[model samples]
Target: MPAHAPARPLEIAAAGPLRGTVRVPGDKSISHRSLMFGALAIGRTTVDGLLEGEDVLATAAAMRAMGARIDRGDDGRWTIDGVGVGGLMQPEQALDMGNSGTSTRLLMGLLASHRLTATFVGDASLSKRPMGRVIEPLSAMGAEFTASPGGRLPLTMRGLVPAVPIEYTLPVASAQVKSAILLAGLNTPGITTVIEPVPTRDHSERMLAGFGAELTVEPSPAGRVIRIRGEAELKPQSIVVPGDPSSAAFWLVAASIVPGSDVTVLNVGMNPTRSGIVTALRLMGADIEALAEREVGGEPVADLRVRHAPLSGIEVPPDLAPSMIDEYPVLFVAAAFASGRTIARGAEELRVKESDRIAAMAAALSAIGARVEEVEDGMIIDGTGGDPLAGGATITTHLDHRIAMSLSVAAQHCRAPVTLDDAAPVATSYPGFFSTLDALAGVALK
Candidate 1:
């Protein structure tokens, strides 16, 4: 399941109830930040439950290239000895960032003020994604970039030492853009501020504080104002990553859609900023119960017990989009099985993910005989009233891992088998996805 493996087609058929308790991989957001922040800290930082997926591995590789001594122990613990603030070494070669947009964008911020020049290259899919959102802010802080047309990848950037600090307001609610600015502030010489009109996931903010950076968040009339003082050293600490709720989202929706399915996903990160899927599903009458809710690694953790239930579609609130942006593709799958029409709006961000998720999901769903309409910002889906879909189409996943997995879950309630053009992309985030699905359904899907 390597990131650059040959195309592997997958076919999933309607299966019996998916019943079991499963623990997904580590939270991808936390896994990426843990490695980056650990690399920037002054001492040894140890991480447990690190996701060894291709995306997080890409981050680990990038940090190692920039002078972090990172190693994984036999006991599944990763230890990083950071070079401290202003101590990054210039990489000897271009950083190859596989298919991870998170690795590329966040590292752009991490390198913006390091007084080093780095060239970044990625796979074709990542190359097409817009880097301008991150580039615009980091460039404002004095980083010079020579990017592809439209600010795409295969870009060379020269970092600025003693980078200028600025209060940048988000033109969009993107955690990557916000995180890049904060990461750049770590090497800058003054107070760096970001104004987020709508809150996205706050993993960057929380993890920065955990690393002992002088960062603060205050409520603003516009939204949240986050300020980080630059040139501050980070302290290394032990971290235990929680299960990714984004990965857990697939099972939650699967159990809700497939009759007689009951599944419990363990130790899920329930950070309020990233729990919009849970909220939206609850509104749609999904039978999701939070069990053993508690704190883990300074974030809320819960074991989610979901039982099959008839769902009624409802208007997905626009404000919920930021928290659950990555989960929208699968949410559309859940919507397809609900009792009525589901309308999703204010999610234009979906258009720019690994694929145009809105259109991708629309086309894939429609091809399989689900009623879906592609909208500019989002999608409108008419459910089958819990009926199984006629799944005789081969879906093109467009090299998006979420798309591949989301459609796989949709196949659970399909009459025929649903075929994916490529499932290799699933290794980027959830390498164990198919195996886990097999275990839940008690059938081998190949």
Candidate 2:
């Protein structure tokens, strides 16, 4: 079967007085990593709170195709039987990654050092994304690729045993790219190093260490230097994935903008690298508080209570973009309800996501009767300033899960019901999004 999921459309209306507590799905990033790292580790890796989304499921399937035994039990925990390091078998067919860029790129890295060839395929959205960034680095490590034009997907990679280890600096701040190279380094001899000029999410580095890999991160004048020993063995781990901060972002923005809303999102991962949205919302004067701060599976966790607030926009710090890159669409929703203008810059990375998020958000905002200036890299939005938005319009999702969910949040403060061309993509990251939203907004879906 094709890994890409079919689409379903949705209509969102203004539901009054969003209240009570809800936990969003497990972190998408962590969920993908748990299966991947577990597949590389010997022994059984038990994962609790795995996001049962299409994207993460695709990763698990890819791992299975490569000889890892992964099973999701009736009790909701996942048990993975790894092939151990350097033990992956050549798959009989192309590995379909669906719409998950994290899966495509990271799997390429995992496949780079083995002595086998594998073909990768993705959905229409993922097929259009440039894979050249990954191909270039892996080629230097002696892996060979025959890819579509512009280095897009539907490509084949031939892994190189005893791949060369090099110290390379990243041209862009991408956790995916950084993680890809690090995973490739695991089976090479000696140390493989990646230099990050602007640090993105550090989940790979953190989780790699938790799986017993010898990895270290050090600060330098240039940036953060990460080194991982090669030909290493990974021990299995028992993991409890904290709720996704990115998924919590939609509600955070929703509760802050909608009148009379008091929402507490529980068990969210509070890793500094992934908490930029909360920081930006606080800066914009959103009444959001992080309560019961604690640690789980080596990452920070907390409960966030957000209340309706009159917000004023400010120029979002460019440096904060990497931390909350996935949360920008909803941040723009919050901006629509703020006073004055909110300008987000230095986020060119948004252009290469499942869609051109910069233009996508701009168009959706304009369709909902908000003023948005779409720039090459980011956007400038003028808030409705606590006034209800003129939202009797249908918005396009462009096969992006974030776009669908973000527009849904915008409907909370809209004067009329908002519709999405396709909300099914929400399953890529947050499958229970509509249901959770309905529960909080007091809307029943029949």
Candidate 1 TM-score to native: 0.99
Give the whole-model CA lDDT for all candidates, comma-separated.
Answer: 0.94, 0.92
Give the worst 10-residue stretch by lDDT in candidate 1: 1-10
> Runs in model 2 with CA error above 4 Å?
1-6, 444-446
Report each candidate's C-alpha RMSD, comma-separated, in the order given. Answer: 1.4, 1.2
lDDT (10s digit) by residue, model 2, range 91-134? 99999988889999999998899999999998899998999998
* Candidate 1: tens digits of C-alpha lDDT, residues 104-151: 999999999999999999888888899999999999999999999999
- Give candidate 2's TM-score: 0.98
Q: What lDDT score is found at residue 261 in candidate 2?
A: 93
C-alpha TM-scores of all predictions: 0.99, 0.98
